[model samples]
Target: MTDPLGAARIAIIGGGIVGIALARALTLRGLGEVTVFEKEHRLAAHQTGHNSGVVHAGLYYKPGSLKAELCALGRVAIREFCAEKKLPYREVGKLVVAIDESELPALAEIERRSIANGVPDLRRIDEVAELREIEPHVAGVAAVHSPQTAVVDYAAITEAMAQDVRAGGGSILLGQEVVAMTVEAGRVRVRTAVSEQVFDRVIACAGLQSDVVAKLVGADPSPKILPFRGEYWSLAPERNDLVNGMIYPVPDPRFPFLGVHFTRGVYDDIHVGPNAVPALAREGYRWLAISPKDTWESLTWPGAPSLAKQHWRMGVDEISASLLKTRWFRKARRFVPELRSRDLVAKTAAGVRAQAWGRDGALLDDFAVDQVGPVTLLRNAPSPAATSSMSIADYVIDHFLTVRAD
Candidate 1:
């Protein structure tokens, strides 16, 4: 069979998992001559490398949404990929606990969503004894358990995918930031500081700079990338017993964040946190890593007032926790009563999430994609993005690329 896209020239912006996954998908299928441009000197340098490494089990997402659908399919794909590459993949399981009766209603809603989303072996544990069976130190009135929730090294997975891309005849260029783009006559001419290339199609899976890249293609900027930094603290190795697998709080439905929680990483090291706080820069990983321009843009955005008005309380709480270890420790102790302040020894390298917010201050909850001429942009792909990379690649190709072999 002849490959219709074999003659096509394809350009992928961003060297994160999603971009690399798309390149691998296209090259493996003999779809096109694929080239990936990454601004960073290495792939997965940003979101892909900085995450908590959990392969979510479609528990919290709204049913029928892209997150729910892609996460389900993506989990299986990732497991298969890891098996194929002999990478470490551990089904550590996850427990979402409602600390008190007040949180029960919300926990029930999560249970409903989990069941509706077909979370495998999902069980609602109302008795404290039942919850103890899973996480012995957990303190909660009720909980929902997903035994299939797992963890893996996403950065390793991304590198493995890049290997496949190379094996399949694709090219990945590092430190090639796409500074400019021009879409005309059904082709996109992408330019970096050092080089320029024209392609039949360009797809940007740029995590943090998605909106900025979209602007290059003359797309809407309403869904602006609002970088929210999530900081974690490493658990003392001796205190790793505090968490059996992963213990989480029933997330506040009013916001998109999952709140501070504990995760036993794939390597059996436990870490706590990821409180959502506004980042001072697009790539701000630490509090001191500030950019005045990025700060000014967010403060002056049209939706600034509305967002502040709606989430100021949460903003204050999260910021407080970020600044003070005691506040964060209290939140973590709620899930595991045995968690001591001293147990959370050191703060880990933080991750900045590219949360998309509209002009009206509504944070986009579902995955968003936009098409500009032949350029396709992923505007909002947080949390499960690393998990959903391969599925997202298949989705974009099937729905947006609009090409098939003859």
Candidate 2:
């Protein structure tokens, strides 16, 4: 059955999980004639592909927040989608461990938050023995175990979404970088590097370039995006038995980043230490992969100077860990005492998170979506954005799409 608005032309920028998910949803609903414009040749090339692929169980976010709501719902939705599509979905579970008495308060806070968020099968284990039973190699005085927290191949999911979009008569235009967008009359005119096209509605999910894209569409320039590079190190294949499931640290309440921890991938590969370091470039994976334009924009942002002054100590620590592999291993070794420097030998892929910051240097923690004329800009979607992609698509379509009374 075709929707009444099937004739409407919709354009989505960015080909990450969120963008692809939105495309799939709109096309499947027959809501519009949808087209996805991805700057990269392949989908999920940035944050989507580079993330740890953990389906969040709504632990850290405050109750009633978008992150809490979407993550709680999206995990179940994603599991169902993966099952229907015959994709890899592993419910190996996760343990948020507290190594000492000092971290127990934070762990308890997480437990409280998790319960309020209605996370399934969540339990707070007080005994070290119980923690050991859950994660054999993990050493912690207390732990909050979420049995339903799972992992999946999000890149595969993104590709599957693209396929779904194509099967539903939608087009995915790869390598088409959107330079500018103008709202003329009632339609949005999107100008890409290759060509110019007009869309009934344009949704930009540009990850690293989100702020830039939003500015291009005449949106407010506050809450500028600062790209923070997360560097991961793969555990040695021989030491695969270090942990059975995901082992995350009790995140510092002061900082937005969840500290360096362990994650078991869908393929049974273990990864450690995605320390948050300010990237010199938006797409900077390595220290040398610098972009002058990206650097200049970040350095000059009103929030950057204030942010630096506030979190200089934490920033310095992350930079040191990024430069020295030993420093990174030391951070991880706090939870898993047996995890040696040799275990953190292999360098895995790096991801740049587009974290939004206010003029006062405060980090924006919740989901941000706004409309400017005929265009909708997804300003900030960090960590669990991929986890909540399907739900987000639903939210966007329900709210952002304009009704044409014909």
lDDT of 2 by residue, 1-406 (tens): 2233557899999999999999999988878889999998899999999988899888888889998898887888899999999999999899998888999888888888889999999999999888999899888889899998999999999998889999999999999999988888978898988899998888889988898899997899977888999989999989999989999889864453658888899999999968899898988988899999988988888888888898899889888988888788888998899988888876879999999888888999898997887788999898788899999988888767644422
Give the runs in model 1 whose Cα sits over 4 Å from its true position: 1-6, 254-256, 403-406
Candidate 1, 353: how far from true, in Å? Answer: 0.2
Where does candidate 2 have its weakest 10-residue lDDT segment? 397-406
lDDT of 1 by residue, 1-406 (tens): 3334547899999999999999999988778899999999999999999999999988889999999999999999999999999999999999999999999899989999989889999999999999999999999899999999999999999999999999988999999999999976777788999998899989999999999999998899879999999999999998777789998899865453658888889989888978899999999999999999999999999999999999899889999999999999998888888788898988996899999999988899999998877888999999788888899999998887755311
Which candidate tops TM-score? 1
CA lDDT of every candidate: 0.90, 0.87
lDDT of 1: 0.90
